[model samples]
Target: MELAIILMILLIVVAAAAIKLSDVGLTFPFSKKTNLYTPAERKFLQMLDMAVGDQYRIICRVRLSDIVSIRPNTSVKVSRSAMAQAATKQLDFVLCQKDTMSPVVAVDLVSVEAERSYKAQRDWYVSGALDAARIPHIRIKAKASYKPQEIRDCIHAKLAPLRFQQPQEPLVRGTLNNDKAPLRRPVAA
Candidate 1:
């Protein structure tokens, strides 16, 4: 009977350590492990960090309007230039590259719509086109002047077919930069 009570007490203690204890408000008991980002992922994160900067969170919703894939169709063959021109055209303003897959764009619809709405909506499509084109609204606004439904449909159509998987950076085989800086010195080998 004493052995059974001791075993029961040990099991309860182990369970308490694994789960959230009511004594602590909303605190889980497990130790966490963190994974680090790769160089390319770090660069991408840096760009996003630059774009969004101190605004860690935005209050407005964003939607991607449309995307057209650009290809290198014409080759300058007469000169026999064998270089498969590595000139990469700008894909989009906000893009997230997936592992072994094409990147996805996240457009700033709030900025886009706000800019268009401020211009009185129809200015871009009509005889107001010339005036609107010169006003700098086009640059700040979305490519397609979309309605609520249009924005929803556009994103659904574009993203529905694409599958986003976890980024694989070959499981970084080195120690982390303790100071969170890019400057790496020779560690004692």
Candidate 2:
């Protein structure tokens, strides 16, 4: 009879503990926020919109992974590690064809202030990758004011060559020449 009474008390203690634990639900006190863009970014975006006019679309915070891939024609296989590294990097902006959303250029807004070595290294990597991909990349300094004409000229300079060049074959069919280098800039199509 005593053992039965002890067993019943133990059961009640366990049940009480379980109930107490269950009462402590997880929650956060966060609320929805607005205006994700910073003041400088907003200003630059305005200038960029005016400069490009209706010819191209300006997209912000584009992932590098979306812009590049291990070319399909390459005999070399991209390792999982390489892809994971690429996924982490992102571009500040991408200028695309308005109707087709084809990326025409990639832009990075850099501060004149001294940055950490790692950030500089990452920037170098991004630049090299974009260059290899034959995607024109512009590095703009974060500035108090911008000249729309200058910006327009910069975009035009890069795009003018592409606009004139005619490709003999589609980009997908081009084969990779080596393991170390990226596929040759798709024969100007």
Candidate 3:
């Protein structure tokens, strides 16, 4: 009887407190983000699109874990630690094959000052991990403007070996020797 009354009063008090907090706007205070990319990043994304054209798909703000994983042979503890670390770190952009969606290149946009500071520690880890996985990492200096052709040239140069490994189609239907037959004009003379 007495115990039941006290329990009922306590429950009502707790519920009242929660309702008051909600009425005061203390719950669900978050709002939607306005923009996904900063102005500089937006500009670079446009330039990257122009540079790669239809050759590759561009993924922005990719997590390291999405690109690489801990070895299967690793112990549980080490794997947990590696995953935790990878989950927090992210790459600025990743270029993937359009057909297979396999990540081929990782790009990081860094300011001159960030490159020289403690941020370099993060870069070192990202570089080592990508290197171990045999993925090419390209660091680009963020600036006000970029030339798409230069970006294309740089990407092609790095991907030269990959391009050679893939089978290429002939430019013409037949062999070059047969494509154009030489004329024997002096036979009649």
Candidate 4:
């Protein structure tokens, strides 16, 4: 009788521990979505995006100018402050150009899958773009993420401050350089 009671109590304790552990484990609070910037840095990106007037437009001419920025009120509520590292960009510096000051611009585009290969290039490109637009920005980078609509809204929100029209000659693909026999050498070398 004593052994049976002891075994039953042990089983009950084990089951209770497991139940409690599961309750904590299943919460998964840390599994919340990851972002590339902090709330503040996200706000900066949105502002910069707006100032640039959709130079990085994606397919369908769906300008990212409609995205809204994160409000200062909610910066504290965001969790990803650890990635708020500052970036140093060349365009942010001053260069003497014929006794005149001019902003520098550069571009290098890649699909989302190649992000790791050229992440530095991407950041510098964007920072240069913002500089070309004369949008003053903090030097810090942050981690943040949002839904597609939210991204769109953040862009739009930035664009709202400026007045501009769409470009007539939008970018389109051509096959001039895509042909198999793209070149021929001079007859008399």
Candidate 1 positional error at 108, Å: 13
Q: Poorest 10 consecutive residues of model 4 by lDDT?
A: 59-68
lDDT of 2: 0.80
The residue-level lDDT of candidate 4 at 20 comes to 97
Screening candidate 3 with a backbone cut-off below 3 angstroms (N, C-alpha, C), the clashing residue pairs are: none
Q: Which stretch of 10 consecutive residues in model 3 shows the poorest summed lDDT?
A: 113-122
Q: Which segments of candidate 3 are over 4 A away from where they belong?
A: 1-11, 18-26, 113-122, 161-189
Per-residue lDDT of model 1, residues 1-189, tens digit only: 999999999999989886756558676787755645434333434444455444333111112112221225745572133222212111123433333223243433222345445333333232132222221111223343334444334444545544334455765676567787765678998
A best-first ranking of the candidates according to their lDDT comes to: 3, 2, 4, 1
TM-score of 1: 0.19
Of candidates 4 and 2, the better by lDDT:
2
Best by lDDT: 3
Model 1, position 41: C-alpha lDDT score: 35
lDDT of 1: 0.38
In order of appearance, the predictions have TM-scores of: 0.19, 0.69, 0.73, 0.26
Put down candidate 4 lDDT per residue, 27-142, tens digits, no spaces: 85766569755454445445445544434531211111211123355555341231122122222212112323232222222224344643333465445435545542222223
Top candidate (TM-score):
3
Q: Give the residue spans of candidate 1 off by over 4 A.
A: 1-84, 97-102, 105-144, 163-189
Cα lDDT, model 4, residue 109: 23
Displacement of residue 175 (Cα, Å) in model 3 is: 11
